[model samples]
Target: MHPFKMLSEYGPLLLEGAWLTIQLSGLALLIGALLAMPMSVARCSPRAWLSVPVRIYISFFRGTPMLAQLFLVYFGAGQFRHELQAVDLWWLFRDPFYCALLTFVLNTTAYQAELLRGGILGVPRGEVEAARAYGMSAWLRYRLIVMPHAYRIAFPALGNEVILLLKGSAIASVVTLFDLMGQTRAIFAKSFDFSIYLWAALLYLLITMVIVRIWRYLEKRINPHLQRRVIQAPKAVKTAVTATE
Candidate 1:
């Protein structure tokens, strides 16, 4: 079959796979971010008990390869099938999609928590002191001041994390999840067409470009102060230039 004809025939399948990829990555990033909030705070705690466990978790996830983590959840769950079945929770682990999702959430949560911890620490002490001076409760301060500023500081890194997670989601194909890469591989097996891989690459690049644009827009919206302000020439100078022209 002609390459374009092959693409035309399988384009919808590729799109469906791309959509699945987006869903997987988007959910992981959302859940990871939510879980990261408390973990980040715990990571910042002065108490050893509070910080140590979070430190260990972050270290383990960050230190390990994501593929290993995915395998542990997807394949390792079988090792405890009887125990899981006894607990009536085997259904969740038995599905490859859920196993992949669980692994992604765990991995992204660790990285996001560390990023947020850095952001929280970067919050200016004087700003925090001023909030304290205003008689704000700890929770209130976190809600009103600290978290917002921290998110602003960490927004770029968080965007990078999401992009990384999106790319990493391709590994889900290893577990039999029909993500974009999985579909590409399937099509390649039948068609023996190398161009299918190129199409997959283009789709990945297009998705990434969309994500980058959206992230940049959100970053600007959230941190308007960081955007450079446009300055206009003085009215007199403009008039003089206009007259000269």
Candidate 2:
């Protein structure tokens, strides 16, 4: 089949797959971020017991391949199907979509937690001390001060993780989920055209570019100080130019 004709015929299938990819990646990132914050905090705790388990969790997920994690959640759990069914949770394990989601969430959470931990630790001691001087409770200090700073610091890295997760989501095809890559593979199998892969690659690139733009907009919104500097720089330069003239 001609590439354009293949696209016209299968375009809806590809779009549906792309939408699933977006949904999967977006949901995983949201859930991962939520889990990462607490894991980051626990990892930062001074007590060995508190930090050790978190450290291990982070290490295990970060060190292993995402594909292995997916299989572990999907097929590996099949080994205990009787127990899961008895508990009425087998339905979740039986679905490839849910298994892939669980794996993505857990895998992303580990990496994101470490990014958040670094961001938290990067918060200036002076600001924390100032919050303490104001008699802010620990929770208040974290909520009002530390978390704000930490997220700001972590935003760039978190954005990068989101992109990685989005690309990595293609692996969902391995378990039979008809995400973009899965659909592409199916179409290519019938058509035997290499351009189908190129089409899929372009779609992925377009999605990535859109995500990068969204991240930039968010960074501008969150860090008004940087925006202000950007706004003022040209005005300052203009003033100096006028004086010289």
Candidate 3:
């Protein structure tokens, strides 16, 4: 069948795949954000031990390709099944979907931590100093002042990461998860039509566009300071100002 006709024929199946795509991406972002919060604080802590391991973890995960990580969890983890079973964590790691979710969570946590770390560091020292002068404790000072400012500064970049990871949930296909990409591939295997694959492509594009729209809306709402740079037109000359005064 021609690509366009095949697209119409398979529209419902592709929509199913797209729905799954949104599900996986949404889960990853929510879970990833939750995981990153503490990791960010740990990296910024004064303690070398706390920061060093986090730095290494971020370096290792972000530095490596996500596909490799998925493989490590899915195939490689089986190599350690006996050890994991001893700790009663094997069931969680053994399932392919669990492994994929775990990989997405871990990967996003590393990236989000750095975004947060940059945000925290960018918080004005004066705000913290003032908070201290007011007799607020260490935790209170950071909570009341530093975290808010730091997060606002780097939000655009973090928004980008959130969108990217959401789209990247398609890669869970490689680990045998029936995510959007995987389901599309499965359908194409039976139909033997290149156009089935094209429908899959369209499904991905549709979800991606929706994600872009959502991020644009959210980034606008979250970062008011970014609006400060809109250059205003110069006011009408003061030729009439004397009459007004």
Candidate 4:
């Protein structure tokens, strides 16, 4: 079948899948970001007690594949079914959708927290010292100065992470969750049409383009001072004429 006709027939199914992909990615990013903030702080703390556990958490998640994490949550949890049921938590771990969501959120948080930690460490010591000289409290310094600067430095990296998360959401299909990739696979399996996969790839590309554009727009908004100035001829010409006059 022609690509357009195939799309016309299966467009709604594809759209539904895309919507699920968006929801999964968006929720994971939001919740992951929230969790990562404190994790980043802990990871950067001076005390070993505070930072060591965070280091381990980040290392394990970052070191392992996301698919493994999803599998552990979705399938491996079955081994603990009795324990989970006793705690009234079986409902969360039993559902593929919830398991996928949990895995993605946890996985993203590990990566994001490290990015944020890098951002935090990148803050200039001199600026921090200046804040200290101004008699700012530690909390005030973090809230007013440190975090803002950290986020500014980390924005591009965080945006990249979000894009990666969006792509990674395709793994949801592996856990029996019908995301865009899953739906595409189903269509291909049924129709035996190669064009459907092409359509899915194009849709993924479109989504990526949209994400990149939004990130660029936000970069401009976040750090407008970094934008290049259109250097025109210096007013030196007008100044020379006025002086001659």
Q: Which candidate is the best by TM-score?
A: 1
Worst lDDT run of 10 residues, candidate 3, spans: 230-239
Query: Against the true structure, candidate 2 has what lDDT?
Result: 0.93
Q: Give me candidate 4's TM-score against the actual structure.
A: 0.93
lDDT, candidate 2, residue 102?
94
lDDT of 2 by residue, 13-94 (tens): 8899999999999999999989998899999999999999999999999999999899999999999999999999999999
- Per lDDT, the best of the predicted structures is 1
Q: What TM-score against the true fold does each predicted structure earn? A: 0.94, 0.92, 0.86, 0.93
Per-model tally of clashing residue pairs: 0, 0, 1, 0
Which ranges in model 1 have alpha carbons more than 4 Å from their true place?
235-245
For candidate 3, write residues 28-125 as lDDT tens digits: 77898888878899999999999999999999989999889888888888899899999999998988878888888889889988999999888888
**Count: clashes, candidate 4:** 0
lDDT of 4 by residue, 1-245 (tens): 97678889998999899999999999999999999988998899999999999999999999999999999889999999999999999999989889999999999999999999999999999999999999999889988998889999999999999889999999999988779999999998899998888888999999999999999999999989988987665698878877999
Question: What are the lDDT scores of the predictions, listed in order?
Answer: 0.95, 0.93, 0.81, 0.93
lDDT score for candidate 1 against the true structure: 0.95
Give the TM-score comparing model 3 with the true structure, all chains together: 0.86
What is the lDDT, from 0 to 100, of the residue 26 in candidate 1? 95
After superposition on all C-alphas, the RMSD of every candidate to the true structure, in Å, is 3.1, 2.7, 3.8, 3.7
Per-residue lDDT of 28 in model 1: 92
Better of 1 and 4 by TM-score: 1
Report the Cα lDDT for candidate 4.
0.93
